[model samples]
Target: MFVKVVVVFLVMVGAALAFPHAPVQQPYYEQQPLMPYEFGFGVQDKYSGQNFGQRERSDGRAVVGSYSVDLPDGRRQTVNYKADKYQGFVADVSYTGQAHHPYH
Candidate 1:
């Protein structure tokens, strides 16, 4: 009986020493910097009859942009847009000139 008790105590001690308590960990987060930028681009191909352009600017809080494309009917379709945290996305569309259809 004494030998059995001694063997059990030794086994418990060995287990306690093998597995130590783990320390609690806290979560970490990273912060990013905000930057302002603006850009514009345009493309015009006379052979392919493709004409389009776009311009945009952003100041971290709000964004504004405009784009225009030539329609197959000869009218130019233009769109002006703006977006922010409060009003969300808003756009205005307009057309210039008149459409022409050629007979086959």
Candidate 2:
């Protein structure tokens, strides 16, 4: 009970310190991660939106694979799907302006 309370307090404190300059703008959209094996595919964050999902079961001792998000504008962002989230192999994400249609 005491540990839980302390943990919660610390989390709140950390969040406050971390996002001290967070945009006051309210998020216009929200998305949840996909379940294992179930994939959610769509033009991720295209035109004006956010796209986020997880390739099911691409973790653990399993031979990791690669994944990509091709926006509506001919831009393919590939990322290695590795064991564990965040701590796994990942290329620092980069941004690119749409040059062509992703529908291609």
Candidate 3:
């Protein structure tokens, strides 16, 4: 019985060692220079790659929202937003490349 237990323990230890695990890398947010066509799953910005914007998808085939980005020429492009990453309510966005006035 003792030998069997030791053998089992050793087997488990060997298996664990053989299959070393790695800590998962969390998705990181990155910044990009102002440009065109940037997109992503959880963040938003100009320069289409990993900076489009973040969204949650919750329902059937689609998610919807909006975004905006500053053009290098100073004009801002306002865009609609939608994400298939999860499907749910996201946020609204608008762009104009001008400073926002906070009070009515």
Best TM-score goes to which candidate?
1
The lDDT leader among the candidates is: 1
Candidate 2 per-residue C-alpha lDDT over 7-93 given as tens digits, one digit per residue, 9 for 90 to 100: 999999999898867568744532344344534454455666666443435323333444566465656566655554447664445
TM-scores of all predicted structures:
0.66, 0.26, 0.26
Give stretches of model 3 more than 4 Å off. Answer: 27-104
Segments of candidate 2 deviating more than 4 angstroms: 1-63, 84-104
Q: Looking at model 2, which ten-residue stretch has the lowest summed lDDT?
A: 54-63
TM-score attained by model 2: 0.26
State residue 14's C-alpha deviation in candidate 3, in Å.
0.7
Candidate 3 is scored at a TM of 0.26
The segments of candidate 1 whose C-alpha lies over 4 angstroms from its true place after superposition are 1-33
Q: Find the 10 residues in a row with the least total lDDT in model 1.
A: 25-34
